[model samples]
Target: IPTIKLNNGREMPVEGYGCWKINYDRVWSLGSWLFNDDNRAGQVVLQAIRAGYRYIDSAYFYNVEKGVGHALRYAFRTGIVKREDMFIATKIWNNFHRRDRVVEGIRRSLRDMGLDYVDLAIIHWPMGFEDGDDVFPMYWNLSNVPREWSRNGFVETWQGMTDALDMGLAKSIGVSNFNIKQLKVLMDSSKIKPVVNQVECNPYYNQNKMLEFCQQNNIVMTAYSPLRQGYDLLDDPNLRRIARRHNKTAAQVALRWNIQRGVAVIPKSERRRRMNENINVFDFELRDDEMKAIDLLRQMPKLLTFGTTRSHPDYPFHDSY
Candidate 1:
């Protein structure tokens, strides 16, 4: 796998596994019940490790920290991968954005994951939500509450994030779901600038201007949803034509295109074959023309903008990129 040097001089794998939208059937069902079913989630993590995936992305919002932790401990005990070889990344959810609770939130995640520290810890979203809806145990619903209620708290929360790095609970810290303006606020107020910004990036939502901004600022950009929520880019005419021309899978072609642009990608899958296939983009390269063709596809918009939801009052869409 290729590597990108972060602003703090830490090296990160260019392509990793994302464990978002993972459902643990026993613990969660169609309605409001919580149970325990760690088998499938545990197996997926182990399979990812066995398939040579060194980087793993998890979040408190995912509600599978214990399962992830159990799987990691099992993998290490079974000699699947060494501690130094793995890069584990998790996030701080919105409700814990209060200044006092920020560090505690991270500590809780570490406790849940059974790890002392994580490679990268991110503030999950720039905005915070009220904690009542039970979307995830830690998730607060922002569906109706406006952004103004949480903006100040969000900044305070970031200060606590910086403090986490100072105290050594997280090696490197950053933000996710932040737009240009939110990032600017962080840059201005922070003692340490965020080393990375993870956001939704794919052929449909290429985020060219955002990418350029982060690149110019020396902040690493990690592309989540690289396959567009499995919307069948693999069978799409343009991507498939490009894939055939380059002798690659559409997924590989998409990942390779992002890699060439110096963007990190986290494409998720539960199938062992797809897990291996997602990481096999190191050999092939995309030409300039093919890259441009992918770029043209970005003109068609897809996916929700991070802060543009009706619930966020200060959505940065009008003011910033």
Candidate 2:
């Protein structure tokens, strides 16, 4: 229930639900099935909304836009919540980097979500390569870099995004997966500074320097993968011990740690009980020593550093993430 004030004069929730790995088998039965059942996906979103979650994070790359859109519509129709009460966020995929195509992509997402406008829109990734003849190319394949990269296309795409804000298509705009150098370039060239930078963050991979840079620049940082893709932070002895001392769940402890550091977090879950548990963090507070103990737990490597991707000739993180 905590909120952060954006540089654009809007308040965003400090914690929210993320739908990155949500099951999409029912909607699109494509290759490498992770999980199925769109009904369950819709229910999870509805439950999150009912549990006082005002912010929902999603992306075109996730391929579950229909389910999220359906859930939002159903929730409104059922009187669970009003449209204005929710902050719906979606991202532009890497493939749509050109100026005209970026606008077309947002229109397609608006059509898919059945919404007039999104509360915020983010460029999904810094790389802007086209997909090959294959539907989904290998992570390392970079055969088709967009021509715009040669001509500073990101600046043009950013201008289109700014136009989206002026045209009332998106209330705010930002970037994702950008390193310090790329972020600085955008900041220098952009007429409207990016209000948020979504990136991978957690106790294990705390981005102190990046967080400080964004803080100094008035860009809110939204921490994705806060639990490291459910890599057992909830069961850590240190976290459990701190949770017991504060009478809170280890998950809440992790979330509170990020919120206290002034970084927004989006922890995803399908279980209704866990969804409720994740949102119930406003009641209790973690002590200063406990917060420091959690901060000290930042020994793990970055989970989604862009350098790992094969597209970049210079992967930026050779020195640090």
Candidate 3:
């Protein structure tokens, strides 16, 4: 697997496995209905490791830290991937964005995941939620966050993040779902710049500007939802045609496209076959024309915007970037 060099001298795998939407409720989905593997998330983590994935992406928001931890421990115990070399990335939720609560938040994530340190610790979002025991939103609570809290909270939270890095809680600290403006704030104020920006990016929502900007600024952008879901993006005539040209799935082409652009991808898949296919993007490259054709479909609906929190002062969805 290829590695992307970050600002802090850290090398992250260009392709990572995402551990989101783990299907804890066992809802009637394709994976559960088709495979009947109830602990599909954990099972796939093990499989992903074997399939050549060195990096794993998860977050407190995903609520599957215990399961992810268990799978990782299992892999280590079985002599698959060594704990010291594996790259694990997790994040701090909005509720913990307060400067005072930042350490507490990441500590909880570490405890839940049972990890001593993560390779990367990201600020899940730019917004800061109400100071409370619960991390999830119960109702619209824009007021739960202070009016000037956005910039101030981010600064303070970043200070705590720097502290965590200093203490070796995480090897690298970064942000997710942050736009260029927020990044500018950090660039202006902090001594340690963010190494990566994890965002909703794919062929449909290519995030071309963000990718270029991060590269120019010495920040690597890790892409989540890197694989487009549904038939339109994956099964479209042009993408399908391109996939066939390379003897790859549309999903593989999409993942490869990101790596080709010097961006990292964390694609999620529960099935063993699909997991292998997702990481197999390293074997080929998309033609320039094929890449442009997929980029033309940049209008597909986004996967995770946290719309209910849009009213918050720090909500990042409204930005053009």
**Candidate 1 positional error at 111, Å:** 1.0
Q: By TM-score, is 2 or 3 better?
A: 3
lDDT of 1 by residue, 161-279 (tens): 98898888899998887888788888888768898999888887798989999999999999999888777666678888988887888888988989999999999999899999999
Point out where model 3 deviates above 4 Å.
26-40, 140-152
1 or 2, greater by TM-score: 1
Candidate 3 contains a number of clashing pairs equal to 0
- For each candidate in the order shown, give its overall lDDT on alpha carbons: 0.80, 0.78, 0.80
- lDDT string for model 3 (1-321, tens) is 989899988799998988877644532232123333435567767788888888989887676677777788888888988987699998988878767687788887788767889899999888877677656534544333432434435777788898889888899999999888889987888889999999999888889889889988999998888876543678767778888898988888888888888889998887888888888887787888877787787476677877666767777778878
Model 1 alpha-carbon miss at residue 186, Å: 0.8
The clash number for model 1 is: 1
RMSD values for the candidates in order, in angstroms, are 3.0, 2.9, 4.1
lDDT measured at residue 1 in model 2 versus the true structure, 0 to 100 = 79
For residues 229-317, could you state the per-residue lDDT of candidate 2 as single tens digits? 77877778999999888788888888888898999999998887888888888888888998899889846777666433444442345
In order of appearance, the predictions have TM-scores of 0.90, 0.90, 0.90
**lDDT measured at residue 320 in model 2 versus the true structure, 0 to 100:** 63
